[model samples]
Target: MTHDPRTALLSAALDAAARGWHVFPLRPGTKRPALHGADRCRTTGDCAGGHLKWQERATVDPHRITLCWQTSPANIGLATGPSGLVVVDLDVPKNQDNSNSSADTPDGATTFKALCERTGHPVPTTHRVRTASGGHHLYFTAPAGIRLGNTAGTLAPLVDTRAWGGYVVAAGSLTPGGSYETVHDTAPAPLPGWLLELLQPAPARPVVPLRLPAVNGSRAALAALEAECAVVAAAPEKQGNITLNRCTFKVGRFVAWGDLPRHVAENAFQAAGEARGLTAAECRSTIRSALDSSLRKVRPRETA
Candidate 1:
């Protein structure tokens, strides 16, 4: 007995919907969304009031899933945000790349494994999918009230993540390469604490206003410089030098525009970084380097 392709696709959508994942339709045999874009919206149905993107419109209702897949042999698209999933996509190098050393190039799986070993973490076992390109997707449940955005090469080279603004071509989808199949039939594990630490944004630090004596510059420039110095002074522990560099670099644009003098900016940053525990030498070196780079990159004031 042979299974009808349409029926198989419908079953795939329903299965994902059953697991509480919000499901959308991918174009037949591809990972692209089948939904219309905002620009193409006709102000009808779901978009009567405003356009709903694929993530906003993804559904977990079994009735909607059945009705959708019955019309076409569409692939299943799992919206990671709505489903509370954070999927790590481990991908192989593209087949079209003709580099002679391609065979030795580390793929996402290899890099991710090395990262795990270095961090003293075992490769997390979770609900996994083998994608058409022979890559893998490891699904983890996102922590409540935390929304993570998609990342490319942030965790490790070749490793990408799909979260709030992303989706994954789920198991049972097909492409020219092959079919995506469930390699591990299990519930998704909660995202690891260590990984969560890496993904979470740094906590915002409170900046106590800097009271600098009168300086030679526009009032706007003086205020901006003071605020930036306060940010450096309030940087979290062990982050003082990095914060000093960033803040000084921002003020450098004003220097380039002649809104502030370089000496004044440098002097203020030096004082702020020293107050925040950075060595005088470290503060001077970082401030000089940051300003140099910022000045070099800044466009002419008129164009800017």
Candidate 2:
């Protein structure tokens, strides 16, 4: 039986809607939205697949999906965020938008490869769509109260997330390059704990300076840093997060002594804490509390 591509896409659209994903219409045979003539693409970024009012227009209504497909077998796009999806879009930039330049950009697959190596955490198993550009759209359920964004190159250079301001071309959408096909049809998986933390912005970590050590001691400033950080990293997995927090408070005492610059200590300790299983939130809270409470209001001492 020769499968009708348009009919197949329509069926897929209904399936997605039934699963609670808000759906929108993409231009036929394209990954772009089926909107034009002053009612067109006003939003940018990952919204390259949709429009300014894409969210408002997205629907789970069967009547709307049928009407859209009847007009034209428009490619389907799934609106992210509101329905709790955040797609990890892996892009392979083949050419500049304005020019026919075939300059090579870091493709999504390669970036994802690098990320696995750096973080020592593998990408989670999840519902996946293969893009026409040979990229991937790994869908994950968003955590409550956390607003993720379309970030590129920070977590992994070639990776872009389709979140609050973006939409992903649905599995059945046809692009000029090819169709967005499902690699995995199962339920979308929860975002990994580490990844969820990585996606959010780093919180403010301020350190207050206090009086310097009078003798400064036989202990080199860096030696103290090295020792305190070792203690944090060596914390046992059982109650490890608590141990790291207390060690951080001790390190904050060093910051107060001006032996360690706030940024340097925070970065070292954070990297260590993550390696030891502290969530980003846990690490930040500990560091901030330590910085706040560890330093005393004593007067400065004379330098030797």
Candidate 3:
């Protein structure tokens, strides 16, 4: 006897729910509904097949359904639990030359492996979804109790289990290739220890907001310099310099440094740093430190 895909999917979801797993459908292109109950469908159109009912039934133990997906109803689902799932969106860098590639590079798989090792987690089941940009969504789940959104702006690697496809292995939820997965069964792995600490399931300490110093000429100069420093601090492989230069140019225009003398440019840079929260003295000191270290290494072998 042939099994219906919809029935099969619902049964799987219900089974998972029985085992304390939260179930959500993973149909793409369906409108998300406003209903809060698990028995109600959260989408409409071809992707809406029996999802509402599944959700309503699952809601009986809302925290038990891990996730659910329907291909005919257009690929969608729901996530219910104490800690939502973690999703890593991967994209290919524009600068990288991938003209001759057909599958995820070695580096990509290696990165995924490293993340799995770091998180002490195993790769759960995987899925391929039709994405908005005509790309494929590769899904993986981590163990329970893992936090998702806490690593929103982090870069992580992904493994392409598909026979043909590639992905970006950088930080953060926004990837050039596609958006990050919104739900999963387990917490994302290889989560940085610091991030894990921040995402502890307890109420977090209130962060003290720092007050910026008054925006004076000096403060503006300092702010500019601080901005430049931030650019210099980024990874060289990540176009840090270009980004920094763009920010510097924008500051130069804002502070009217374009019409000023060369010395004024320096002052404006310093003032910008101060305006952005760094002290003028600190900005100067950091620049001097970088220069001093560079000079020490390059200066002809000190003539004793």
Candidate 4:
């Protein structure tokens, strides 16, 4: 007998809810959240008080899961924080260039293994999910009395963690690339003490105002560059790289117009990002890539 796709998806959602995971619906065949974002809120239904983000709205209720999936074949989204989980997302390299054009360039799993070895710890066996992109998500129970946030490239290259404000596609969910499947069907183990030490958030630091070097640029351009640099310098910990990328991209039009020299902006933002505790390498890569993308898409000066 041919199985109904909606039934299968509903089953996936219910199964996740059964595990005490706060579950939500992902867009069918995609990883993106299916719920309307804050901008689309109409102050109705779930938004009666205010707009609730997907993470806040995620529920472990089987009835809600069934109702949601009964309407469409939506994929399953698991809110790691509400579920008391910290998922280490080990991603694969995107292309040959990112892989350093070397056959030996380690993927996320390999790098994580090396990290484990260096720390003199065995790889923790826990609930594991294989992503559609040929990557792995190692699930661990979060330590009590401690709240952790998401991280990017903090553990290692291609290693990211999903915690508060982040979610992961649960096992049995389907994406265009393939299905997210359970590889290790076991209860998630408590986070390893050593790994917890590595993931523990640093004490909050006060953000200092940035001082920019004078550069040859239009007055407006200079002001804009300085403003964006301050935003980078004051970015919250664990969020510096994204803030730097966004702020740098916003200022890239000045470089394209020759009002701000590319190197001047690059150097200034690099310093600001580093001051915010981002690694030098992470800042450099994010700045260059954002600038390149912005520069390519910028309209001609005369058009502006």
Candidate 5:
């Protein structure tokens, strides 16, 4: 079978460990190896002599040596698949100000630290450089029974440690914009213990019933209403400009006036009413009155 470079690299590292060798795993972007104490490999198959020696020294605990790949680098090219390794994507935003004076801490680094604290795991001292994008890759040794999986959308598996990827630590997950700060390998502030405790567990809330209005009793009226709604719902996209009412109308699955663009859909109802010999203004006013009545029914009354 043709050799997969990533798999080959991992297999060699594992084999070296089995033979009482200490292996240090590294990634492409950064000068520092993700697994410290080992130097970069010059080629796909070649390991620096120092790294080989370190691997030999680590042979007593073969699990010490691990390969970590960056799966969620902003630039797609350098992202890698999980090879039974523990990959932690530190999704830092590009606009993040790394300067210490800034009031806001880097969301990604803060989140990473939080995860480590919560899990009672020591954070790795080293990080991998991502291609072009400012995100850093951190790899941690996985707790037993977790193996990394394949890439899905923007997410990729880190090494073989499945437990590590796809978790959203509020701090580490990137915002709508790309920017984050590095909390690893620096004199960062301690993560709040209270936040970690709150994350531990919480009670579930009771579910509330959702009530929707019954459709008009007349089949002909219901069909006409449905057709009118369909036309109004398609209007925004058809016109190539979005209005608040159009947006609301589009999101509503049911033909409830409350769910629709009140004024726009009301106008359509008025037009329909006029065509059917009812006064346009009266039809519109009726809908407004119904909406007001429904709103009052749903809301809690003020207590004296």
Candidate 6:
């Protein structure tokens, strides 16, 4: 016997809950949620609450899934940060055609691929979901110890990350834009360490001085720089190369602000990459590419 499409969807939601994913109901044919009064929801550190919006109360309970879907056929939306998973959301590029098809060769995918290639980072071959607009959702287990935030263009233009304070429509959801479908059979892979480092905000660190100053004891600060050097020096093959570049670029900004002595900072950056096993030539080339611009172009820190 053919199962009702709505029933199949409800069953799918239950299956997701079984995988320890919290889910909420979305409108039948759109990413817009089906929760009532969701717009009026608010939360605070001391207290949190929402209006009728179901997202304020998404659940993983099988019973809750049944109650939600049975009440009305709804799309499935996975809350990202709350679920400890992050999704790389490659959105379909805009089109004047308005052909009404979800599938298309949008700029987001191309940009993402180029970024991966440039970073020497491998695109994940793990669990993926195909979005209606020909975009894709690459899912990964959030790395421990870093709070990743949702961002657009943090990685590349048209590419977005859904982490804390964000959500992604699940694979089984149907939207007027299109239906989400699983593209890969495997479970999500742990997010790559190099990528995690890139996603995380850089720690606030003062630049190393030309010589130890008698001004004050900041031995701890110097040690932190040493640790950063270690990470670059030991970065995994090509994958870590981009991270090293990014690290150097951040340091260059400090140099631009006069927070770090340029000569001292450069020597430290070179040492870090070399320590991470990079050849002197490789380190020199990357350091130049990454730091030259910021030094030439960045403005000094602004006064309050």
Q: What are the lDDT scores of the predictions, listed in order?
A: 0.84, 0.71, 0.36, 0.85, 0.34, 0.69
Model 1, residue 163: C-alpha shift (Å): 0.8
Q: Candidate 4: where is the Cα deviation over 4 Å?
A: 96-102, 204-304
- How badly does each model clash, as a count of residue pairs? 0, 1, 63, 0, 24, 7
TM-score per candidate: 0.67, 0.60, 0.33, 0.68, 0.24, 0.61
Question: What stretches of model 5 exceed 4 Å from their correct place?
Answer: 1-82, 97-105, 118-121, 141-304
Which candidate ranks first by TM-score, i.e. highest? Answer: 4
Q: Across residues 182-226, which tens digit of lDDT does each residue of candidate 4 receive?
A: 999999999988777666754444656677987778999999998
RMSD values, in order shown? 10.7, 12.7, 13.3, 9.4, 18.6, 11.3
Ranking by TM-score: 4, 1, 6, 2, 3, 5
lDDT of 5 by residue, 54-142 (tens): 22232223343332312211111111222223334555444456564544434455544544554456655643333234545553333
The alpha-carbon lDDT assigned to residue 159 of candidate 3 equals 24
Candidate 2 regions with alpha-carbon error over 4 angstroms: 1-4, 36-52, 96-106, 205-304
Off by over 4 Å in 6: 1-3, 38-56, 96-106, 204-304
Q: What is the lDDT of residue 275 in candidate 5?
A: 37
lDDT of 4: 0.85
Error of 3 at 3 (Å): 4.3
Measured on C-alpha atoms, candidate 2 has an lDDT of 0.71
Q: What is the lDDT ranking, best to worst?
A: 4, 1, 2, 6, 3, 5
Q: lDDT (0-100) at residue 95 of candidate 6?
A: 75
Best by lDDT: 4
Give the Cα error of residue 65 in candidate 4, in Å. Answer: 0.8
**Cα lDDT, model 4, residue 207:** 59
